[model samples]
Target: MSKFKYLIDGIVKNNPTFVLVLGMCPTLATTTSAVNGMGMGLATMAVLLCSNMVISLLAPVIPNKVRIPCYIVVIAAFVTVVQLVMQAYTPGLYETLGIFIPLIVVNCIVLGRAEAFANKHSVLESALDGLGIGIGFTLALTCIGLVREVLGNLSAFENKFSSSDGMLVFVLAPGAFLVLGYLMVLFNKLKDRKKKA
Candidate 1:
């Protein structure tokens, strides 16, 4: 019941991307393609899950004055591990993501969860929170990336959709903002309708 609320909150009511609007850096920078978006999402999710668990375990031991710094150290350690693994196994995606991978160390979603949720909750709850938020973030990015890829590159899931004809702009930085803005508007409208119903 209440234990599961944290998970649902992250995915629906308090989504890191759509609702909370946290972690915009990677959301905007690494989502140039569907694959890139999924890659970035999973990488961030891994760090989020691990860090949240570890932070929860250490919360009682950490001093209040130095908690933030301690959280950063824990988060950075996980990010480093993820980075090395990505570089070793997924070299292409690793290269595509570039600095954004390491940038996850400072992602607001990670820090926010660490400080706001994990520090106050049990290990299982914190892990679930991280997983839910990570999934939400991943889904949002994947949707945006899928749309951009289809419109910008005329491709989806490695398959070409209309003979390589595309808007080109949809693949750029401005396009990310444009798509995200429209999606946000649409999402809000849907939520309003749901509430009314």
Candidate 2:
């Protein structure tokens, strides 16, 4: 009910990544670097916010059966905007991010929020949801990215293609899966303890 509660709810209790478990594609891909993770997160946030606002506007008119397709159209439009802008300005990120950029359209987190929270809520509240979930996704990816970069490349978020430093053999795709699995287990245990306390 408080203003800060909205903010906290978005980032913590209702985190899209750790809590809702959406958007696993970019979560697994561009998260190799803090920068990459941040970029993807922000891009997705922009699209989410835009789509949420539009969906909220059209919620009354959109047929329930066709709502899914409508959401995709809105999301795809925003994602195309991101792809073009990124390709034009941040070509390096464009290259590094690769197919994942386009994949944001299908990201469960984006579409899920659009269908669930955004359509039902006010535009402002939906924006808050997007902001909260987007930031949470960024933070989780950045944490994993930091860990992978440090242990695997002797740096935080070094180029995935270039291993200029010592290779710890635990930062690749398989290692990321291992780390994500362990992190999920650790988070689950923490959640259990929190409930107990």
> Which one wins on lDDT?
1
* Candidate 1 clashes between residue pairs 3 or more apart in a chain or in different chains: none
Q: Taking the tens digit of each residue's C-alpha lDDT, what string does model 2 give over 1-197?
A: 66456557878898877778778778877767667777888888878878888888888899989999988998999999999999999999899889999999899988898877888888777777777777787788888777767667766555555556645655578767777778888889999999999
Q: Which segments of model 1 are wrong by more than 4 Å?
A: none
Q: Tell me each candidate's RMSD, in Å, in order.
A: 0.8, 2.7
Candidate 2 deviant stretches above 4 angstroms: 1-4, 157-164
Taking all chains together, each candidate's TM-score versus the true structure is 0.98, 0.90
Task: Give residue 39's lDDT in candidate 2 (0 to 100).
Answer: 83
- Looking at candidate 2, what is the lDDT of residue 93? 84
